[model samples]
Target: MTAAVAVIGTGTAAGWGRHRLGRLVAEQTPERAWFHVHPPHHDLWGAREPVVCDAQLLDCFAAGLRAELPVVVSAAPPKPDGPTQRSYAGLAALSRPSGRILVGVHPADAARVPFAAAGCGLLSRAVPGLPTGAREVHGEVAVEALPGWMVGTDASGEPVTVNLPPGATVLVCGAGAAEVVSTVAVTGRTVGSVAGADVA
Candidate 1:
């Protein structure tokens, strides 16, 4: 069956988190073909193709669904100030019932993401103590590498952390944070082989 993971939030942190989470989901489920919907700023290493525009994104999701693959989408949170909120809503609308939504937000802005919390299956952040639910993945910094941060969580809910090479924090806040977001992305998947396909 077709599955999808949408990483939605605001600012550069959200962007980087989306990239990290998408990669993690892809890694967890390599048996199926994967498509990506990412902004121009982010670079996706492996994907059958890159989907641009809302129409193309929807089309890719539909195609992946038909092919029983997975579509990884990175979108801005559905907020009034967010430029791509409409796209986020569209993705949410289309991925209902079986799709997963991972919302990444700053700890201070936790209360501001009410719209997403209504439907999101996972919440990723640097700190813990969010309103309790079965869908929250809390992350905290455990160490500070020379140029990277090691994020880990000891929260009661699902723990999301991944091991990464030192100083690999280019696109994400840190490797640890990336792992946290990614853990939420693939929380319950079995988790890729299209080569040379245009990954925009």
Candidate 2:
């Protein structure tokens, strides 16, 4: 087994007045996989509403990822295809100073969704020895396997950096009474192995 850390994402069809942590490890939602643990560890969200993710928990997650395994794959279906015409104004433009990215990855190719609205933006720095594949969102760029070990802030995902040794089990907590448990597995083309094994 490897180590993995879950980060907060968007909300879902969850209850109102409750913050739902986006927990997905390979496009598999908590409803689908038991390993997804992006919920609260304690009664943090008990009487409160609009639960904010714990910064300390994020730190713990980042630590677990440092020495563990991290394989970034599509944990959800690629965003739906729409008009090539892109729009970026109002809060959408300001809220995301770094903009957003959408991608679809397969064993063969990964397509990158082009953000034509933002014609020019610096691409993320190179991840020296990781696998690379194109995203199928047309004019998009290749989606690099996000570093699970050492990570720098990009303002986009602004993901928490977790440092874990090989085969570490991490407990994650989120709003309400929810929790997710996840781990990372290491191997050469190890991502493929873990994904295949997971599917099985």
Candidate 3:
């Protein structure tokens, strides 16, 4: 009754696109991605807080969750509107139990919550040859290699790159990994990625 997960930021042209910050004047597309779902216990380790983000480039891509655990910074969700393009485009995590990790880019609730990460992993194949490895859903956990990367808009800011493998144990669902990935090849902004306990 007290485990958390929620990271959903669909803003900008619609809502949730890496927090879409006033682009040229703002006004992307895809209806600005909605923006919602981020509740790691009332906005990250709650205590009635707002405006979290001490900044430091968040150790450049989580830096393994702030050089090995322990972080502080909340409040960075508001795609007021711009050349917006975000509904679920990258960034969405939900791993808490004190470990605290619900990154949905912005909005809250691990991007509209739909979490389930049992164990062993590796779910990437909706087409293109197939064969990544790791399996065992419902029958009792066994998923691995939840890997895949390629965020967006670098020079303008907001870019995450991480495509690891080899004995992997990951959790990087940017844009909810395009609603369950399947082979990941997003154009921009994600609006879905639900795992009912499989997908790696």
Candidate 4:
């Protein structure tokens, strides 16, 4: 049997002192789903991308994420939706950062987090070889999918390719999480599959 898998999105909840880490489990009894998690308050708020937090809260969250098959999907918003919009400014606190990613992936697991840092327009470049049909929240761009990977034009309009791994889920929030997880619930596949079965 496949081990339990969990996906989490980090952000500061509006009107709350604690930070929120939205969790999506693929092995709920009734049905797999996303649950709201309000961790203890920490002074490390409003830091830069891949924000770090208090060791206590970070350890707690990290412990919760650990499993036989653990997967943490921390979504760092490239740009804030608005002044009031929640964002994951503290992901690096819980996970280590190599270059631009804050992550915790089991080496045996075929999972990777390749996302663009703030101000970079071509998000697809972060995860080279993305399939077609990648929906950019900020722009309308057409991308093509190769047989084993994907290709898209980057900030300088240069062709960039990305190869997404199986079971990779794009970290999202609220309604977006619901939509993405619902599809996973029905199909028994990751959102990356929706992007293209070749990758997932």
**Which predicted model would earn the best lDDT?**
1
Segments of candidate 3 deviating more than 4 angstroms: 1-21, 25-39, 42-48, 65-193, 196-200
Clashing pairs in 4: 52-93, 128-161, 128-162, 128-163, 129-150, 129-161, 129-162, 129-163
Q: How many backbone clashes does every candidate have?
A: 2, 35, 58, 8
- My TM-score estimates for the predictions, one after another, are 0.16, 0.17, 0.17, 0.17
Give the per-residue Cα lDDT of candidate 3 at 50. Answer: 19
- lDDT for position 91 in model 2: 14
Query: How displaced is residue 70 in candidate 2, in Å?
Result: 24
Worst 10 residues of 3 by lDDT: 116-125
Clashes of 4: 8
| Model 1, span 31-150: residue lDDT tens | 332121121212222111222233343334334333221223232222322334333233333221222223233334333333232222111222121111212222321111111112
TM-score for predicted model 3 compared with the true structure: 0.17
| lDDT (tens digit, per residue) of candidate 3 on 46-150 | 222112222332233234222221122122222213222233232422111111112222223222223211110111121111111211112111111222344
- Model with the higher TM-score, candidate 1 or 3: 3
* Candidate 4: worst-modelled 10 consecutive residues by lDDT: 32-41
C-alpha lDDT score of every prediction, in listed order: 0.28, 0.22, 0.25, 0.25
Clashes of 2: 35
Of the two candidates 1 and 2, the one with more favorable lDDT, higher being better, is: 1
Model 1 global lDDT (CA atoms, 0 to 1)? 0.28
